[model samples]
Target: MNAQAVRNYSNEFLNIGVDAAALGMSRSVVATTNDVNAVYWNPAGLVNIEDYQGSIMYASYFAGIANYNYAAFAMPIDKQSALGVSLIRFGVDDILNTTELIDSQGNIDFNRVSLFSAADYALTVSYAKNLIFKDLYFGVNAKVVRRTIGKFANSWGFGFDAGIQYERDDWKFGLMVRDITTTFNIWNIDEDAFATIQGAIPGQNQELPETTEITKPKVQFGMARKFDIGRTFHLLTEVDLNLRFARTNDIISTGLGSIDPAIGFQLDYENFVFLRAGVGNFQKTTEFDGSKSLSVQPNFGVGFTYKGIQVDYALTNIGSIGNALFSNIFSVKIDYSFFRR
Candidate 1:
């Protein structure tokens, strides 16, 4: 089978929580993150955090049909080290299960029209410190993931991520490896609960879904440069290369394999306002005529900061895939420098 046919994976929620700024920049923050959100982007950037930092974010996705939320807190352990924790939740609520049941007389049963919820959540504990070498940093993230469907079925998984960063003058570089141990999801389905589903429809025969899925590791390398146009205005440009691997076969039929490149730009006015834009997720898709074409998505966002509080918003275009309006993302961050060095 081709890679596309066998591309079954689970726990995709791990990729849903993009901070507002990063989302605005089309997730081009791998080499530019410098706050609590670093825990989700490039943990190595955490070392740049001065004292204590916290972030909270929420987005109403898919026209409010679903939602995503994130929160993170980081504190310096010492002059050269820091610890952080992050949580993410993505789910849909009150979905009406329209599967109906009929009585002996073929009468409709209202009880069968129930509601259920499906949710995915993850918790990540991260640690970062400056490397022995100057201007270098390293970090790691330990994560636990859970997915549930109103209790009928649940899955649990664990994964870890590691990253390294180096900075020289106004240039920054980063390398991140996600799912370093090859994450796996073990699913447990309640047969008894599902038995009712089978009995509801006399001629229906349903089989249990797969119990496990393994997600391979992915690597991202990024570079960014900051231009101090003036003491009050600055520009940051970044590019990231993403690579996906497969177990035995080539990741994709394309000789280029699973490689995607993303680029972003951010403009800042002093420390008060920000503007960002980016394009990413480059890929080749077969057209109806059996011809392949290149495609990508464009995104943009804006932000404002005052005192120690910051707010950011982004609009991410899903292109023709979603057949809907752009996704709206937002986030807030606060830094407490009470113990600043």
Candidate 2:
């Protein structure tokens, strides 16, 4: 059974910035988010922020083997405009970097080790405005990304995102272009630089070659429906289709890949209690036994709201990635409306 999981984008850290509710809903939230979290998912959703809002979230995998943290704030610019800022950090600490040792006999030694940390981070500034036409909204994101592999190498990149949303009654439609500008990561350590650095290390004898990675644009299409069962009960159903663009060896040749879809549902009672469920991160593989299988991760979350504060918790199954351990995600958000509509 050869099973390999592929992350849609080379920037895997993008997967770590979702809100608790979105994570619980299998990430089918492009059209459902309405708060500061929208800064990461779909900036167009920021138009739903009434006055001002702020949120912070943290998620740990396998008892802190890895950590993901996110924070965001959004405020209205005017009756039809909103702006937001967000930050995301994901990383593993205390990683041991091992280098082969050589004895007098030129025998290999395995005791030499170095400790370092690896991290991926991003900062985003977003803006959204309701168009003059009906309920149409448009938004954009300007972001900077940094990735580091210990001290050996680091990369910096800049990207832009844009999104549009249309709402009518209880239905919402959304489309987002993630990394619309085709982000490029420039590494600090190239082959020539690595050759000089590696030569100075007593135990190192090989040079490292680094290549720039280009993250192509991705498109997300989403639709959601809100059902008001009664004065105290409500349900939300949503779906999102994600398509990624990839470039061939020529770099200039790009095309769309397979479409991945996600679905989720949320139930709420009196705006005080909320329940959410979702399944995503899908992949198809043929095991060593030559059996075809489809794999997807499932997550569940619950939330409480009182006054202007909301707390959300999600139990996410990490599948084999976490040795079958369940990961926990927690988030808190506060919203205030200077003038109630």
Q: Which candidate is the best by TM-score?
A: 1
What TM-scores do the predictions have? 0.90, 0.85
Give the per-residue lDDT of model 2 (tens digit) for 69-156. 8899999998889999999988899987653345447676667555778899999999999998869999999999999877777889
lDDT of 1 by residue, 1-341 (tens): 11111232456667654788887777777887878999999898899888889999888877888888899999889879999999999999998765455655779888867788899999999999999998999999999888888757888888899999999898999999989887877778888776666777658757766777677787889999999986899999999887776432221334434666789999999968999999886656667889867667788999999878889999884442425568778889988884342
Weakest 10 consecutive residues of candidate 2 by summed lDDT = 245-254
Worst 10 residues of 1 by lDDT: 1-10
Off by over 4 Å in 2: 1-8, 100-113, 190-207, 246-255, 317-324, 338-341
lDDT of 1 at 110: 81
- Runs of candidate 1 with Cα error greater than 4 angstroms are 1-8, 103-105, 199-205, 246-256, 317-322, 338-341
